[model samples]
Every structure is written in C-alpha cells, then in structure tokens.
Target chain A: MQEKIKVTINKKPIEVEQGTTIYKAAKELNIHIPVLCYMNLKDMGIEHNPGGCRMCIVEVEGARNLPPSCVTKCTDGMEIRTNTPRVLNARKTVMELILSDHPFDCLICAKSGTCDLQKMAQDLGIREIPYQGEQSTYREDTSPAIIREIDKCINCRRCETMCNDIQTVGALSGIYRGFEAVVAPAFEQNLEHSPCTYCGQCVAVCPTGALTEVDQTNSVLGALADPRKTVVVQTAPAVRAALGEEFGMKAGTLVTGKMTSALRELGFDYVFDTDFAADLTIMEEGTELLDRLGKHLKGDKDVKLPILTSCCPGWVSFFEHHFPEMKDIPSTARSPQQMFGAIAKNYFAEKIKVKREDMVVVSVMPCVAKKYERSRKEFSVNGDPDVNYSITTRELAHLIKQANIDFHTLDDQDFDQPLGESTGASVIFGTTGGVIEAATRTAYELHTGKKLDKVDFKQLRGMEGIREATVDMDGTQVRIGIAHGLGHARQLLEDIKKGKSQFHAIEIMACPGGCIGGGGQPLHHGNSQILIDRQKALYKEDAGKAIRKSHENPFIQTLYKEYLGEPCGERSHELLHTHYFDRKKRWIKK
Target chain B: MSSVKVELHQKDVDKIKAIAKEHHNEPEELINVLHATQEFFGYLPAEVQEIVGEEMNVSAAKVFGVVTFYSFFTMTPMGRYPISICTGTACYVRGAETVLDEFKRQLNVEVGVTTEDGKFSINCLRCVGACGLAPVVMVGDKTYGRVSPDGVKDIIDEYKDAE
Candidate 1:
C-alpha cells in the first residue's frame, strides 16, 4: 500500500491516510474549511455522499487550479492553503455563479434563516452577483405535499444524491445542458404525475428554494370559501411533535393543543387526530402480525417474516419500485394519514350530518408522501377517499402566515371527541421504531396474557440505523429489528435475503429517525444530535401520556364495539386493511 | 422497452385515484398518473397520457405540464448505453469540458438529448467522486480515466466493438 500523505493545512502539519481528501484531513484537525456540500458522515445519516456543490475549494502547492476539497484526495508532501486569497476567490466565484440565476427570496422561502446555501453565501459576503442575468422562471409545482421552483436551484446535486443514493428512488436528477441546466424528473414532468411519493427528501436536502413543500393554503382557502364544501382536518401524530419548530419553537416541542387551536382558527369544521386512526391501525396491524405469526408457526411457507412497517409512505413506494417481491413482507397498514382520511369521510361525515361527497378531509402531515398516500384508491372508503387533501407541517406554517394568525399566542385546545382521542402508544408513532414498539405493547400482552414491564422500549429507540433486541414474553423469545432510513432498510433486507437472520417483526421508515425526522419536517442544519433531540421529544410525549398502548385507547375500544366490531372483523378489513403490489422488474433499468 | 407501455396493478391505479381527489382536480391526477405510468413502463406512451387524463379527471395538457416539471421522472426510454460526462468542478478544471465537446461531436447529440438510433444517450453529471482521474467520461457501466478530447473516439469505438 502507498504511504499516507502528509499535508500542511494553515501552518499545521497533519498526516492523512492515502485516499483521504483535503477536506477530510482538515475536518480531523477540527479546522472549519467552509463547505457548501461537505456534510459530516453522521449528518448524512443514510446518504453519506461526497461534496457536489464545489464550494469547498482549496489550493495545493503544485496544482494548477483550485481543487474541490470534497473529492480531491491528498498527495504526498502536499501544502494545502484552505484560507488563501486564491482559494477564497475561487470559492467566492463559485458561490456568485450559483447566485447569478438564484432567486433571492429567502425572506419568503421556507428554507430561509435555516438553509445551508444561504448561510454559505452569507459567510462568503456575497451581497451582489457581478453578473445579474435574467433568471429562468418555472411555474411553481404546487403538488399536494411538495412545491418545486427551479429558479433557486444552485445545481449542487445534493437533492439528487439523497433521492437516488439513499432513498433508492431516483425521483429527481440533473437534466439538460449549460445555462438551461436544471434538476427535474425526466422530460420536465410535474411531480404529481410521477411515482415520486412526495417524500420531500429532495426538499430536505435542497440548499435553495428550488425544491420545497408545495403551498396548498390558497387551494384550502378556496375549498373553505365554497359553501357547498365542509372541510374537516386531521393532524398526523408526527406533525404535532414538530410543527412548533415553524413558529420559532424548539425542535420536538409538542404543540398539539396549540396546533389544534390554530386549525380551529382556520375555520375547520372539525379538528381530528391522525393519532386516533394510528390507534385503529395498530389494532388491525397488531392482529394481522399475530395472525401471520401463527401461520408462520404452523409451517406455512408463504408467510412473510421481518414484517416491515408500512406507516411510512416513502418506504411503501420504495418497496413498490425497487423491491416489489418484498411487498408481502410489509404489513397491510394504510398509514395513520390514510386511516384518518378513510374514517373522516365515513364516520366523521356522518357525525357532522354532511354528505361524504361534500365533506373534504384535509390531513396535516410531517411527510410529503402522505399527500401521495391520500391520493391512493385503497385509502378510500364509502365510494370516496377518506381524506381529501394532504399538507406538510411546513405548508401549515405557510398557511398560518398567510392567514396572519398570531401562532405564537394561540391558546392550546383539544381535538374533537370520538375520532380525536388517542393513546400514548399511538403518539410514539411519530418516531423511529415507534410502530414496532406500539405493536409489541399490544401483541406481546395479547399473546403472553401479561402486561409489559415497561412501555418505554429503550432498545428500539434512538437514531441508530439498525437496532436489534430480543424480548422474552410467555416463555417465547420474540426477535425484533428496528431500522430507520431506506439505506439501512436496504441493508437489513439484504441480510434477510442472505438468510443471515429472521426477525419476528421489523420497523422501517424511509426517512431517517421515522416520522419526527420526516422529509416534510422543518429544515435543520448539520447536527446529528439535533435530529435526535427532535426524536426524543416524540418519546417524551409518549412517556407522559396516561394510556400507553393502542389496545388501551378508550376511543378505539368504543369504536371496536360500536362501528368496527372487531380488530380483524369484516368491517375492519373493508375499511382498515390494505394490500401491496409489485413493480421491481419495470424499474430495474441498467 | 418501448417509451409508453406500462402495466399497472390495482395499487398503482388506486394511488392515482387518491392523487386526483387531493388536488381537488381529479384532473391533477393525470400528471402523477403519467408519472406512475412512466415509472412502470420506463417512459410515457402518448396513448396512456389520455387514459391517465381520463382516469384522474384532468386534461392531457395538465398531465403534460406535470410531466415537464420534476427531474427524476422521464417520458422517454433511455438509450441502451448511457454516457454521463462529469462536469463537476474537479473534472471541469481538469478539462472535462473538452471531453463533453468530443462526445457531442461523436454522438451527434447535445447533452441530455439521446441519439436517434437509441444506441447511446449523452448526459452530464455534477460529480461522480472519481475526481483523482479528472476529465472522466462514463460510457454505460464503464468509467474511462484521463479522458482527453482525442480519447473520446477510442472510448466510443470500444463500446461499438463490444456490441
């Protein structure tokens, strides 16, 4: 092997392993070599990619031009000047080029005050571009959960990296040439018509306003204006835990009451909780797991092991496109977002004495794919979709701002009764491993005929990629696996494919750290621990709740007796249960 | 695979229906419907756009609007061999621009535009992490290092000979 290269960065001599980039070496010395696309490996979480923004330029003693420290490997006896004037000019020039066509609308952009590119430009003191050119204007793609305005794109390719490399869903990529270059789906197609799933992972990594959650407040207002329409809103469990961030609240602040009041202020007929439907989902899904486990025990060869959670639509659509054969492995749980939609049109419509056709069920979610999920046919019951519209937490923030509501001073309020009541177990559905833990709370107790020692399954919690734990219940050891992020899910699925391990149950969410760290959550910067802080707030909410299990939710118990009849009853199957289909061969283009 | 032959299951059909409802313009579902069709079939066929428009309660024009907005989706089947030239900073400074010019001349196609023969499609990339070998050109699965303008002819010839 070649000897390690010794490089001097800013008068300090450091020995870097061969193949380590200058940025990687500087990072080891705790030197901040200002970067636009150089995210730490841990910050990358699922998508650990190299620099693509070309903002971290550095000068090597013998090199002709500045090298992008992100991808350039260190050489033997190299003297690197990370803060040289030449390096500064190169980096500044790159930043200026990016801003030439960029729309300077940070004040209105959701990514404002928190965007990486904005911070980089501020650091570089790029107040004005030398070349002010006519910018390309794209009609905003105001799809259900995401909005795309291409003019703000720096073409950093971080969104493309995350979309293709991490999610394994190459939804957004670079197309065209020269000044006409842009990031978009093939043929500049609208995202709504694609299998994009509106996961908003692209929006999460976008350094500019080029990729964002589509604004639906105007459409929502239009619906509210029509006297013929009665709007009913459902708030997803994850949205409650993270929506506070938009109102200047700290990450993970539980503003459920405040959110409820805000929705009421928006003139909604009813403020329902998706958590309540989450409880219903657990009841149906937990029973399905138990039934499947029984079948697996009886030597049924067709039984799907490592039953993955389907609460995350990104993960669902991912399996649909790439690993379609594994579709049977995912539980037939139409995520809480969809469950609320199904029940709102059928049950809430009747309670409000409004026709199902006239009632519009709007969902506030911490996911973009919920928009895609709400549009799915299986999510519909009573000849119409249970939910009519889906908006992200960020979109709700925009709506609040558009309505000119004093969000910071809104008094906390409770959700409407009947469909709004939820258990502690349902609340935890916002974070990673929540579905598995919630299911175990009910499944473990129902099978063993004993209460769980503690509702807090610490082993399944946290932001780790793959977590494994074995629990002994009724003299039977239940092996469970929890994985967040699609990359990690791909690894665990590979292990299962190789017959490495057979998990009794597994939980998987497409975005990292499950719903609380969902693609549609408020934008955050480069701090892995910050993501964990957001995740912990969700567990804290679950811990504080009085009823900790889905089976223990009083409203769910009442619903079972009055409407659904049983967890896996005929009515439950018709309204709650769903199925998955395959599409792997179609997308396996090489 | 033809540009527009998609075989969709009930799940895909249902997803399109839900999209139609959410946009309050079942017509809006046409865009996503076309997207789903393209993902399923590798490209959108002209006939399916009409079917998608009808199913989702949107006009074919609206479907076309959606089809032209996002980047990850496509409306045409990719060529047999896809050539992605790196225009990332490191590669560009090392003369990747000349390599791109050579490919454009040789393939008779501009960046992002596939050839009429369907044998090759040339596209540019931000970066591919192989910056050590700057001015790199990727032809299908193979990566050519130290790609000079003159080297472009040999690389395309190598692919042709193999076929």
Candidate 2:
C-alpha cells in the first residue's frame, strides 16, 4: 500500500496517497479549488492538466509563491491554503487577464449556458475586467461537422489534448507563441483539409465556444417548414440515453418516448428511430461477419480476418487517413444512419408515393460525425444526399426549446411504423461492445440454427479501453474484440497490422463511451459517471425489450421479404453496404 | 504566418522521405528530421512538413506546431541569403533594432518572410556570443559584427551581386 501524505487544507486535516496533487488533496477536504483548463474524466481515462490556466492557484505555506493545485504535488506535512486572500487575488487577476483578451459576446455564443469559462467567472464573482488588451482574433473555420471559432480560444489546450492525446487523430495542436497561440490544424488550414475524423471529442471537451458543432437545427427547421418536402427524422439510440440531460433530467434518464413525442411537437412529420436501421445494420454486419468467419475456417487466406465494423464514421475516417492499406479489412455495412437514409429515400419514399427528391431524411444523432457521414458522396444518388441533414441530440434539444415544447411534461409516444420497429439488440447499439454483442447474439443463432438461452454476454460489456471475448458458437470458437476510443482501436489495428491479433470480428467506436458518450451528446463536463450512466440506461432499455435480437425484429423480416432480398445480397449490398477508399493522398495539403 | 503554397514534386517528397529515413522514421526523431528537412529545403513549408509527418508517422499539424514554436525553424521560403540580426542585450544596446530595420527596409520584407524576388529574408535573433562586436548581423554562414544601420545596404548589395 502506498503511504498516505498528510496535508492540511484550510486548517482541515486530510490524508492522500503519495504523488497526489494539491487539487486531489483539497478535493478530499471538500475544498473546491476553481479550475478551468483541468478536465479529468476518470471513468473514460482522460486526464488533461495543462496547468496553462492559472485559475486553480493555491498558496502553500513556506512556498516561494502560489502554485497551481492541479500540477502541484502535496508533500507530507504540507499546509495548503486554498481560499487565502492572496490566492484569491492572484486567481482573480489571472482570470481577469484571460477575460481581458476574450470577447464579451456570451449572449449569442452557442456555449453560453454550458461554457466552463463563463461558469468559472460567475463562481469567482468576476463582475468587471479592470485589465484590457488587444485580443487574439482569427477567421472562423467552418467545417461540415465542427466550427473552429479560434477568436474565443483561451489557450487551455483541452481541444489539443483531446485531438492529439485522446483521439490520436492529430487534427489540432497549439500553434504560434504566447498571445498568438491558438489550437488549430497544421498550416492553420480549415479542419476539412486536415486529417480530422470529425469525431467532435474536441468540441465535447472545449470549455468555451472556440470549438462547437455546426448547428443544423436551422436547416432541419427549413426542411420541415418547406411544404414541398416530406421530412422524416430518425433519432439514434444514444440520443434517447443522453437527450434527457439537456432537459435537466438525470444523466442516464432514458427519454425515448418523450423524445419521440417532443420531435412530433417540434413539427417533425415522421418520427422514426435509428435503432431500426441499427437492427438492419446488425443483420447485414452479422451476415458479413459469419461469411468472413466461414471463409476463414475453410482456409481461405484471401479473406481479411478480424473483420472491423464500419458503423463508426470517425473510425472510418481514422483508418482512411492513417491505415489506408488495411482498407479492405473492415466490414462493408453502411452505418445505421446511412442505412436509414438509403431505405427512407428509396423504399419508404417509393411506398408512400413521395418522390425521392421531395422527401428529406433528417437524422437526430448523438454524433457530429453523422453530419459528415451523411454528406459522403457514395451515400447520395445524383448529387442528392440520402439524409438531407443530420442534427445532433443537443441540436434537437435546442429545437425542442426553440419551439417552446415542454420536454418533461410531454407524454410518452411511440415511433412510426415500418421504420420505427427495433429490438433489444438495436437499442444497445448506443453503448460500446453492444454492436458486436448484438451481432454475436444473432450470428450465433443464425449459424448454429438454435435459440440462444442466455441473451446477455456479460464478458463483452464494460468501460475498458480494449476488451476481447471468445464465445463457443456450439463447437467453433468465435473471438470478438471491442474498442470504443480511437486510441484503443489504433492499438488493436496496430496489432492486426503486425499479425498478432487473434480476434475474428472487432467493433470500434471512435468516441469514448460509444455513442452514449458521443461528442454531440449533452456535455458530460468531465464527469465520466455520466458516460457509465448513459451506458447503463441503454442496457436497461435493451433488457426491457421483447425482441432481443435484430433477426427477430418482425418489421425487418417484412422489409427483407417485401423490398430487400437477403442480408448482404445484391440490393442489400447496394443499399446497406458501402466500399472503402484509400484517402492517404486526400488530406495531404500540398 | 506565410500563406504561400508551393507544389512539392516527387523529388522533393523523396528528399524529405530520405531525411526522415536517416532519422529511423521515428516519431521521436521529429525535431531532428525537421532540422535536416529545413536545412535541405531552405525552409519548412506545410508541404514539406506534411511529407515529414507522413514519413515520421507524426501528424502534419504537430509538425507545423513544432515548426511555428521554434524561432530557428521557418515555414516560409527564406531569401537566397537569409539575414539574421542579433537583438540580444549587448546587441540591443548597440542598435541591433536599427540594423534589423535597415535590412527590412532595404529588402522590403517582414521578419520571417522573403522579399517578392526571394533574394533576402529579415529575421531577428537573440545573440551570437559576440558582445565584443556589440550589434551583429548574419547572412548564411557570414557574420558581420558591430554593423551600423547604414551598412545594411552594403551587405544586401554584396549578397545580391554575388548570387
């Protein structure tokens, strides 16, 4: 056991493990040393303490000067004064200096209510900035999914930490020097020109409006208001888990019914669930998995082992940029969003006698990457995108509030028929490992031609960065690996590249806790418990469903029979599957 | 801050790849690889940095970040005779600012940038350890110490005629 370092915070006794920082020691004594740039999501294993923001300044007894509590180690018998007048004055001055260069346009800022810098200022009672200076300004970078309002950057380097360290995307970094320093892509190029995956984790962690999602709520409204267009909306499974938090509900509160009702109230003509498409995804993806496994077992050396899931657009972009040589390794199933869009525009539109061009398929996702994914040229036909627009869960919540809909008071409602029907497996798609687990549940029964007694595979469920499980599919062992964050996926992909991987199929989601902890989900504010809570809510939703498997979804069966032929068949491959491309030469800004 | 875009040909990419390869193509060897690439290309532009990043397995954005952070590295094309005027304490007291101003005026280029003809670039440095000479100006490998502001035109003319 590590020796506990005794410390006194505000004359209160506290003991912490050796190497514990002053912030952690003070936290034990219920002393909240205010911080702005310090974000530690213990559940997700992301701790970024750049110590650039001198907001958490605390005076140590006998020390030369005040030190930032985040990076300052607490020595044994150390006396830390967290709320001293001197420390308070220093903190105030530091915050004032930061605010002096920052714009005072919180009224119109997208992150006004949730901005950590603003909240910290209010907590410190910073009324007026006595210090004024020339502010650092830059042109706004508007990408398909994210916006880089660099003028608002406070140089916290949180987005830099997320982009480089957490996601390993390398899309952004701190450039220039001191006052001119701002996190941006190489050559100050727009994000679209960089190797950015558009995962939006940077936007999720940004304390200010420097990084934010491209708001498509206005576009969705325009589509709905247009009388010529028959607008259809699909909400991703994770949105139901986290959307309630936007309405002041608990972190993991499942608001599926209320969310469906609220979308209807917000004037959406047809409210569908992306889980239906997720079910279709499982059907298509599971078949591809089994097909690959069957070929591998038959000693087919040409087939790529450990077929990777293509549901995550961020992961797709990651591989397309980083590992283009292994492009053929991932399963070619279209993600639930694209699958929904393809079906909505082609099959559903034809059935309703609505022209494909006249119908607009909008998706309310728990991801900003879905915006980029929907815009992929292959997902569209004749220059018209299958999904006309994709709004985030936060955007939907904003739309609900903009329309004055009482989300809490709204009664529970069901999703529309045909496309709305989903299963337990589909609902679980919101969480990490849920896709492979869902695929396993269906693939097992489909391959063995027997019903699975125990539906839940507990081994495949957890918050670990990389998890692997081997299931006995009757006699044959089917190895499964699941990775949530892109960094962990890189590890697995690296192993596969070096021919060290033993898994048969892998599920990879770029965001931390899968879509429930998506970049576009209601901000967790570094509270990782929110991710766990959202994950739990999704599991609870899965447990309560009558149909536990995607293959068992009755609506899926009817669709396959009436319109689509078979899983991974000619029509399904054309609609539900897409090919990968070598994008190595694409983002090189030469 | 230089927004000049230059097309990197096959040979240029190969040159950067060779530099990165000599450094074992390791991510940790980014600084060393960049130093050599800058020395070879006369400057570290985004195109060259992108190639270095590709060869080094590091991100192009990070390469740019490192290049921008250090005064020694430059992304813009340096002049044929890149000029560095020392602005250290000893040099500053000896009128290094005036010397730098004269160079910029004669060259018609800002610091860290080349003139329109790309003949000269004006940059300011800390010190050259030549306090005995007080103010010092350097062009390529040649160092001119105790340089007055009026001597800047003579220095530019010498480099222009020789090149």
Candidate 3:
C-alpha cells in the first residue's frame, strides 16, 4: 500500500517506508548514533527534531557536507556513512562546544546520572573543550512542579513540542535568539504567574538539567525522621508499574509488594495504596454518573450528561484555566491521591487514634502535578495540608537506595490492612482508557441490576489518542469517550461545546498512557515501548486481582457503611469530592 | 521581559481587541497585534501581553516568546532619550566595544535598562550602513559618527540637563 526506499548506511543495506528518516533506518541496522536535541515518541505521534544540535550528523556520499540524520529522510539508494572519521570528528566537536558552554557541575546537577547531554559527551569520548567563551545564564525559576535552570538548555525544544503540540498547554516556548536564546514562560515570568497547568511533561523530556521535578525527597525524609509525626505513605497504582525500572528491573516489573516493603523499611508507619482511594473514587463518581443518567433519562434537561472524570490534577487545572465555562460538566470527585490524604488525615487517623497534625500522609505518585495538587488550599484543613508530602516514583527509588535496602533480593510483602485494600477496577486506573472501563464495570451492573459475566471491557481499552465505546446497560446504550493527552481532551471538550458530542461520559488524563507515562516516572528516553509495557503491567495486575469491581471491594463497602454513610452523602461530599475554580481570573495577578 | 506591574487602560484594551479582530483573532496575527500594542504603549508589559493573548486565543507565554525573540520589541518602557550603538563588524573594528563599555560605566546602567531618573537607556544594534562613520551612536533621532571612548563624557553632558 505504501512506497519503500532502499538505503545503505555504513555499507549495510535496508529497506524502510518512503518517509523514514535515516535515524530510524540506522536503528533498523542496529547502528546506534548518539543524539542530542532530538526526541521522538512515535507511538503518541510526537517527533521533535529541531536539528539545532549537530550531534546526529552523518556523511552522505553525494552530499557536499554532513547532515543531521534525525531530519534527513531516506531516499532511494542513499548512501550514508555514520561512523566515518570525519563524521565522528564533527559530532565530537559539536558536543565539545555544547559542553564548553555548560556548567561543569554534573556531580551536583539535578539530572546528573540521567542527563542525555552527559551521556552524549561520554559516548563520543570527549575529554576537554578547545573552544571557550561566555556561557549564557539566567535566574533559575522554581515552580511548584518544575524547576527551570535555563543555563542547561540546549535549545532542543522537546518541552516546547510537548507543551504546545502534544498537550496544547502552550505554557513554554523559545523566548530569544542566538547565543543568548532561551526557552521560558512568557515574559520570563515564573511558572506560577504563567498559564502553566504544572503538567511537568516538559520536565519529563528535558535532556539536561534545564528542567526537572521539584525534589521533595528531603521533605519526605524529614517527615519520616520526625518522631512526633506518624508518616503514612500511599503508593499509586502506576508507580508500581514503572518504579522497578529505577532499580535496574525490567520496564513492566510490578514492584507493588517490594515498594510497600521499601516504604515501611524507610520509616513509614503505615504503608497504604492509592488504589484504595481509587476504588473509593468509583463509589462517589460512579454514583454521580448514574444519578446524572437517571435524571437525564427522566427528562431532567438540567443534569449534565457526559460527565467527565476528575481523577487527573493536570486535566483539572487545564480545564480550570482553558475551559472554565464547562467547569460544572466534570464530576467533583477529588483525585485518588487527595482522597487517600483526606481519609488518612481524618477517617483513618481517627481510627488509628492519631491526631490530624501528628499524622503526615505522604503520596508516592507517578506524576509531578501531584505536587501542585497537594498545594491547593482547598485540600487542607485550616493550614495543615491533606497530604504533607508527594514524592515521585523516581524519588522513592532514591530513598530506597539511600536506605541501603537491596531491592532485588528483598522478599515481596503485602500492604497494611484496611487502608491498603484495593480492587481490580482501581488497579486499571493506571493506564489510558482504564478509568472509563473501570467505571463501566461498576455503572453497568448497578444500573442494570445484573452481574457482569466478564469484568474486562476489551472494547474500551487501547493506546489510541481518542477512543469511543458503547455499553448496553439493559435497553439503553451508554456512550463512553476516552482520551489521555490534553490535546485529545481539548477535541472532546470542543465537541461538547459545539453540541456535537454523542457520549454519555468521558475520561481524560493529562499525560500520555495515563499515569504510567507520567512526568515523574523513570524516564523512558524516547522509547515508547516502555510506556506500552507499563500499560500492560497495570492490566496484568488488574487480572491477578481477586475483586475486579470497585463497588465489590469489601473495604470500600465498609468505608461507606461506617464513616461515609452513602456514596454521595454529606460526609463523602466533604472528604471525597471537591470543587473546581475558574483559574483564568487568577492566571496572572497584577 | 520586565516583571513590573502596569494597569492597562480600558481604551488601550479596546485597541488591542480591535487589532486582534482586524486579523480575525488568529494565532498567526499575534505578532501584528503585539506590534500595534507596543506602538501604543511604547513597550510590551506583562499586562498588555496578557490582553493580546486573551484576544488572540494564544497563551501569554507564547506571546512573550515572540516579543523576546525579535530585538525590535521592548518589554520595558523606553526612556525619554533612548541611545542605540551599532556593534556591526565595521563598527566593532573601529572600537565599538570600548564605546559601549564607556556608556555603561558613565551611566552605571546595563544595556536595555534605563537610568533611575528615566532619562536614558542604552541598546545595541547590529548595523546602520554607516561604515563611513564607523562606531556610530544614535540618541533618539540624532546620530553621532566616528565616536571614540574619550568622547563619552561629552555625550552624557549634552543630555545631562536637557530635561
């Protein structure tokens, strides 16, 4: 159906699609070429090859000069020499020039071990820089979720591509030109003053120390060291799916048990799972969905049908800033992390006989936005936050290693009782299209008053950018929409705004592949297969779970029967659900 | 871009909306709207950029990026006397760096920043096609050619009492 081009690289011949770049063709031959300022998430349709850095250059036989292979397309019978002395010399020279401008402080740099630019220099065997001049510098901007050390930027524009093109948040861009050119928020304003959703996708793709997550490991360690405080830690489902990679394990090795053991060993008084709150989220949000459906079916036109899920903090802030007019359309359910916090600080704290201020609820999440979510004033009682510290999966790994715990040889252990209990439905919330499927499993049985023969909604699962499915609830066909990246979410919201949406409900997550590809997860380094593997791990976990439905989880049932009277009762409203704000009004303060 | 706060007037806001409307409020029309706003306000402050972003349906950060990318756009207000020095190859060969350093030393102000009294601001331009009068300096509309570092004191004294 498509044309193919035969290209010869390093005397090896290969045939690929007509538009395949030389970089991909070289990869086909297993000839690895070092790259900088080039990132390609082909699965999500994202490719940022600015060609600003000349590190991936190759010599074309017929061409006058070497061209960067990332952008140079493969043509018929094209001869490309990747490892020639000339090409190597040029690449090394470019890398040296980059290093000359960079600060020689890798030992203390935030991205020290994982920095791509550092790896590039090592791969090219660069020892010293012959060229030297004034290096560009700017004030470091420390936002709630991200840190921008502009001096380390290589003008890669990967963050720009992810922000403007993938997420459509448009919070960052290239601000200047030439030697002094830098990428920053508008007017170089701090991210707090910018229209940043604090999604942290920019931090995820950064090649240098220019962008990184706000390190909260020290605060978490401090809370653990505080003898007066009871530190209760909750690990998100997605964190288990990917945290293993930080310990030299495979991408999809589910480290749930080991992570729980590590948290306990690291001094957490209680090791809980956010999946419990995810199940709790289903209890409230599913009820709201059914209530809206019942009212809509009964001719109550005021009820907002097509209720959107409110589990993603990034998506919540995105809508708050971009689509505030439709704020009431989404369910008022707080994220699983916040729900765990509120319950830990209030319901669980009281059950354990610990005072609210004495119990510090820490969240082990696979997201950077969770940091910003924990900072929301409304999610606090008086001045004390619901979650005292939110650490990333990467940060948790650092702590486990810092404690000298041999993660590989350590025996797997189960989570604590009551608070750690979770169901299969909540486990699936780690991936895209998982939330709606989980909701469907619970909503269908409740609405139809029948048992589901199969729990897995195979029709509603995939890595597709935008997905649609229909579930027959008795005689009614309930339409469902699922989207992962915010750009796709924008399309669904735009359809709703135009009165053209046919779905009865929708689920949206800000990051790619849901929380598995979160900004705070172990960096995939442009390999999208890692994300796919992470998604599969979550589904694998869901399949192995004993209870596959949220409502059927006995602990959640007990939570409702004891502390929270009903699904959407007054207590649930106060502790589980929260409101949205029109952030456009507060975007930039005068 | 400067972080100083400036409250925009209703009429200036209306003018920005009109300029954006003239371009159908498209994201591509962002530069045109920014140019018109800077012309009206004499600078592109954060407040004016916010309004342009609102009218254009573009993010404010993106608008700031475009303003900073081009050397022509200024975020802070220009002083009563804006001084521009050419630093092109022709001028640099004729002691332009010395002239720039002399100005910085005399005014105790950084390039692109105004004096505390708002009387003078210094900037550098690449070329003005005045190689015949190499190392040229321009104060508002007046141009001084063949300028040396020794003449910097006299130039500052000329504008010292003009206010």
Residue A549 lDDT in candidate 2: 96
Q: Which candidate is the best by DockQ?
A: 2
Q: DockQ (C-alpha) of model 2?
A: 0.53
Share of the reference A-B contacts seen in candidate 1: 0.00
List where candidate 3 sits over 4 angstroms from the true fold.
A1-7, A15-19, A74-77, A585-590, B79-163
lDDT of 1 by residue, A1-590 (tens): 76777889887999978999888899898888877665553655543445667788888898898888878888888998898888888888888887887887788886787788888889999888998778876666766667788878777777767766666565665666566667776435676655465667788877777787655667788877888998888887788878888888877687888899999988897888888988888998888888888788789988887677788888888778657767778888778877777677776677678888898888888888887777676766555777777788888987888789998899989999888898888988888888888998999898888888787777777678788898766787788998877877878887877778679888888877788777778876445665777777778888888888999899889878877798888887777778887743332112
Cα error, residue A170 of model 1, in Å, equals 3.0
Ranking by lDDT: 2, 3, 1
Q: How many collisions between residues are there in candidate 1?
A: 40
Per-residue lDDT over A358-475 for candidate 2, one digit per residue giving the tens place of the 0 to 100 score: 9999999999899999989998899999999999999988999999998889999999988999999999999999999999999999999999999999999999999999999999
By DockQ, rank the candidates, best first.
Answer: 2, 3, 1
**Second chain only: TM-score per model?**
0.63, 0.92, 0.88
Question: What's each prediction's TM-score?
Answer: 0.73, 0.96, 0.90
Question: Which candidate ranks first by TM-score, i.e. highest?
Answer: 2
How high a TM-score does candidate 3 get? 0.90
lDDT of the structure predicted as candidate 3: 0.90
- What is the docking quality class of candidate 3? acceptable
What C-alpha lDDT, on a 0 to 100 scale, does residue A526 get in candidate 3?
81
In Å, residue A19's CA in model 3 sits off its true spot by: 4.6
